[model samples]
Target: MPKKSLLMIGVFLLATTIWAALPRVSNPSPDYQTQPTNDGSHVEKIRAVWPGPNPEDRVRARVVMSGEDIIFEDGPTSQVMNTHSIRKSLLSLIYGIAIDQGLIDLEATLQELGIDENIPLTNQEKSATVRNLLMYRSGIYLPAAGEHDSQITDRPAREEHEPGEYFFANNFDANALGTIFIQETGYELGPFMEEFLATPLGLQDFDANNVIMGDPWFWPSQDTRHLQYYVYMSARDLARIGAMVAQDGQWGGRKVIPKDWIELITAPHSDLEESHVPNHLYSHFGFQWWFQEETGTVWANGYGEHFLMVDPTHDLVLVERNFSGNSLLSTARWLSSGNKFSGSLWELIDTHAMLVKISDS
Candidate 1:
């Protein structure tokens, strides 16, 4: 074969292989559950919120559903960005996995875990065990440890006692929870990730570790997908993950994540509605995962209104990547205060003009 012809054929085959894995456009309907697709319009003002001022920016937005990603960006079959604390939520997958394997007890107390330190944590914080931390109720005084709020402009930790300062303080430091996990459990992060979650999921091109060198160093990758590159992938893969959970952790009829582990990971450990906007009703956290609490929506969100949301009730998975949004925490607070989509995860994402996804692909 001519060298140029051979190259063309190789390209065609690669494209075909990627096409098979890429998502297909989903037919929509008013009813997507117990019936058919509830075709939602992509004509919202949301585009103003996608990351990157122009499509040329390294940032991209996406949306996936039912094993399809109708929203896409750039020219690659996969990409990357930063999911931030969203990584914490993914950590729950392992936590639940450990519990399901009888490596840890869900009901274990803090003292049982030997975590009650001399720190002045409140009774709520001290009594909190691994479960409370999963639920974000360890009551640990974050600002006390030097957390700072971001939007205050000139605000400093040594400034004043902000109303919600302790929890949301921008404090400019790694929350230490990541390192705490490895320290408490004696499990190395990278090796365990390869062993427990990544390998079983058939996921490569990712790394989860403390890639820093400071008091609270060890930053996880901003690329959440495809090996810490903001978890870059087609929406079909995201839906596949959700569908796996919806199907009780079964992937092509194989048990990837333990069944009991899925249930525990998705189940709530705290009050999600603690923050809501537009509608005050809410679903919150189940360990690191986000749940509607009311609608049984499980999610892991990022800096941009980047979301991987699943409505287990209706077998729906909706992902939104906005340029900037304050996320669930601030968004709900801003909304309850009777405002617009103020301080939302979507808004935070929109600010950077990065990537977001939503799909019925």
Candidate 2:
């Protein structure tokens, strides 16, 4: 054999060995046998329109439900992936329960709650109430864990507005809510969610142990005062959450979340003009939820295309998950790209269009 050919063969063998040695995380095979009745036509229509033409909008799983019946499901619906900012909406639900139990007071001021930060909060900033945090109107701007660069850049100056006087999609408010919940309720977020929210809704793929405190892979050195409480949930499990909300917080005839709490959280607290969300489709902001009153729909959106949409008018719930894979290479690429690797606006628009069509049918 020629020397060049032998060298090429040796190089190929070495590359193959290295590739085989790399650790891989695999999504569990979907259990098709136990999957609910799926409408083939609906699934096909969704596939044709959703995720759009963006290469970054890699949708990993989707599940659509009408009432208690799952009408469509695709990909690994059982695989638990990061829920990202949807954790905020989950926290809202937990707050509802805590408030009902008299464990948390919405009107309690941050000063009274002892919510001090590393940089120190102003007296005016400390006057913000728990309800203000839930509405993202806390008006305290500080570096927060799990925040994107755009969010940080767009954040209003510290003490720009008094508490409850303005609206901004602030991660500081959400993360602080996590702190307040733990302090007032004396229950860690994960176990409390698993008990009060997950188990009640019959979530099949939720594990309290898997809940993360911060994005260790990306923002490892974020402020320790208020770390983001990240939740991991399967598409199917998220669908269950959407279903309960769609049913006015009722799950199988039992009131899982208080009806008044549901009504209050879904009500439009901040108008589009005030909230300044980039998406025109969402007309208002509720307590950690986006509201489209025209369609009578509420949404919980997370980074990288994770969504939980509830349409009470049609009794429909839709969940979409985009897992960017857990490989070190993927994480490295995400970090290298300034942590801007997220789902496209076009994809979200397309998803909304598809949902409208499916609901109409």
Candidate 3:
């Protein structure tokens, strides 16, 4: 055979090997207890607030909690799907654990981490720290997978705010965090998530096999690149995470993460910057988690109305998964267009408000 044919054969075998290794649900349909008696009034309220004539058209899954138990749930709680940026919240969880294990130093600078690109980082950008990335204040301004172009356009000139003075919800921040994780620990995101998080939380659906890089094309062709990644988790497992957060990193009487770290990350760090996302009720961010002051609810929000909300005051954890109006690629383009999204903008607002009412009830 010609050398080129041999090369093609090698490539085909490599692709097939990787595909075989990817995680699949051995038991996709498991016996999940459904709480028919759990108060669904809040879900009904959300249905009323949603735009579509039929609520089922908008919401794909929901999980409501009272303390550690699932009080109510409707829709496809067992169905696994991409929750978009909610993966950031999981990254945040990993960060807390990483920090506690002394694998990462929040105070460490980019220069110290040896973090640099082929495109040279300005001196000011090099001065950023892990904390700055967590706060979305690095101001490094690299093109990230899920970021809107308008955000890039609106961003201050390079080095405008030093490291911590400005706040923008750029995918670069999260991607850089992923890079830092691998650099510090020598583990890719998937395995790290499985060993440290899924195992500890007793999650039924999450594992290294199911996790995939969030933006495969962002740093494509770069041999030394560390790509950002995301996880596909079911509503029930998402609630497990929420319940853990509500319990200050404890699950089933075990301390899954340091309680102090949980407090530090969920506490308000900076006010959210203005964006095309119109109906966000959150005012501040903490370690990638959003903080709503009026309701004392800390949440992990994703594109297209994915939410995992924790209200400690009422011992409630809620997870909502709804249809993304467009495909991920199309949604990325829509966001880049600088036009506001109309269809699902209100879901976050309505969900938060309803959670408050649920707690009050």
Query: Considering every candidate listed, which one attains the maximal lDDT?
Result: 2
Give the alpha-carbon lDDT of every model: 0.44, 0.78, 0.72
**Clashing pairs in model 3?**
214-229
Looking at candidate 1, what is the lDDT of residue 161?
32
* Each prediction's RMSD to truth: 14.0, 6.0, 6.4
User: Can you tell me which runs of candidate 1 are displaced by over 4 Å?
Assistant: 1-58, 67-77, 116-124, 144-180, 208-240, 272-282, 293-296, 320-361
1 versus 3: better lDDT goes to: 3
**Candidate 2, 247-322: lDDT as tens digits:** 8899889988999999899888898776546767788999999998776789998877677888887788878787
**In candidate 1, what residue range of length 10 has the lowest lDDT sum?**
27-36
| Two-way lDDT contest, 1 vs 2, winner | 2
Candidate 1 lDDT, 1-361, residue by residue in tens: 8999999999998886665444221212211112113233442434455333343332334553442223323122132333444556556666666666666665555555555333433444445455555655443433322222442443333322322223221222223344345655567554565466555554323333321122221234332111221223223334445656666676556776788778876886555334211234334446567666544567776553456766554454545443321223333333344332122344433422222233222
lDDT of model number 1: 0.44
Worst 10 residues of 3 by lDDT: 27-36
Residue-level lDDT of model 3, residues 1-361, one tens digit each, is: 9999999999999886665444332224323322223455455665555434243244367777766777666677776766678988889898888888889999999999999865678888989999999888897876655566555676566676778877877777787888898889888887887788877776766657567764432335323244557577788889888988899898778898999989988998876645322335887788889998877889897766688888877778877776442234433444454332233435545665666775677
Candidate that would win on TM-score: 2
